[model samples]
Target: MKFTRRASANWKGTGMEGTGTVSTQSTVLNQTQYSFKTRFADGVGTNPEELIGAAHAGCFTMQFSFLLNEAGFTADNIDTEAKVNFEDGSIVSINLDLTATIPNISDEQFQTIAAAAKEKCPISRLFKTEITLTAKLA
Candidate 1:
């Protein structure tokens, strides 16, 4: 049970003025553009932190769904948002905001499963920074 993914980046010129394109194995983002402005300022291109957030959110939601099914419940909908905070060129923390709708499930049960998912998800374990989760049943 092992899997690996790959992404590559090519940059030119100085940090402030350089530009680059990032490509992933899935090609969901094929040679996507990114630059200093995109990373440090409000630019038109995607950044690493944004991509990380997307990955984290996707992973957590899927893991939560698995947990719910194992608990004999099915989730009607699960929405998760991951906020990756980068400060001083380092990742400081990640905040996961989750809202879910599951029939016949108590808030306590839902919270318990969500907390377990947050602790056991693969992406959650990859981060060394503090990971916080806020889960709500809808």
Candidate 2:
């Protein structure tokens, strides 16, 4: 199976002073504001790195849940945070912190599943930089 998602960004003005709006086909982000201030400085809009973090966090959590279920365990709750580092005008690394609550699952099994999910997630595979996962059972 194949699927495609699309997003568009429109920018105007100079780089330092320019402003842009990002729109996605899903409409979850419609005309979302982003600018140099948002990316390089503290501003009132979202940035590309933040978006990538969100995607990674969501993808990893979902993949972990699937793995848990396949291993005969059901996750009662799963929370993940992806911190993406963007430095020197390039993406450096992404660190994922995950906490999950599942019944009847050993710590070793959970760790194995979490590591597999982190390694095999589509979003994780997209980046060439280092990706780290810290998982804990809650």
lDDT of 2 at 16: 94
Q: What local lDDT does model 2 show for residue 118?
A: 94
lDDT of 2 at 31: 97
lDDT string, candidate 1, 8-111, tens digits: 99999999999999999999999899999999889888899999999999999999999999999999999999999999889999999999889999999999
Please state every model's RMSD to the true fold in angstroms.
0.8, 0.7
Q: Judged by lDDT against the true structure, how good is candidate 1? A: 0.95
When summed lDDT is taken over every stretch of 10 residues in candidate 2, the lowest stretch is: 85-94
Q: Per model, state how many residue pairs clash.
A: 0, 0
RMSD value for candidate 2: 0.7
**Reference-based TM-score of each model:** 0.97, 0.97
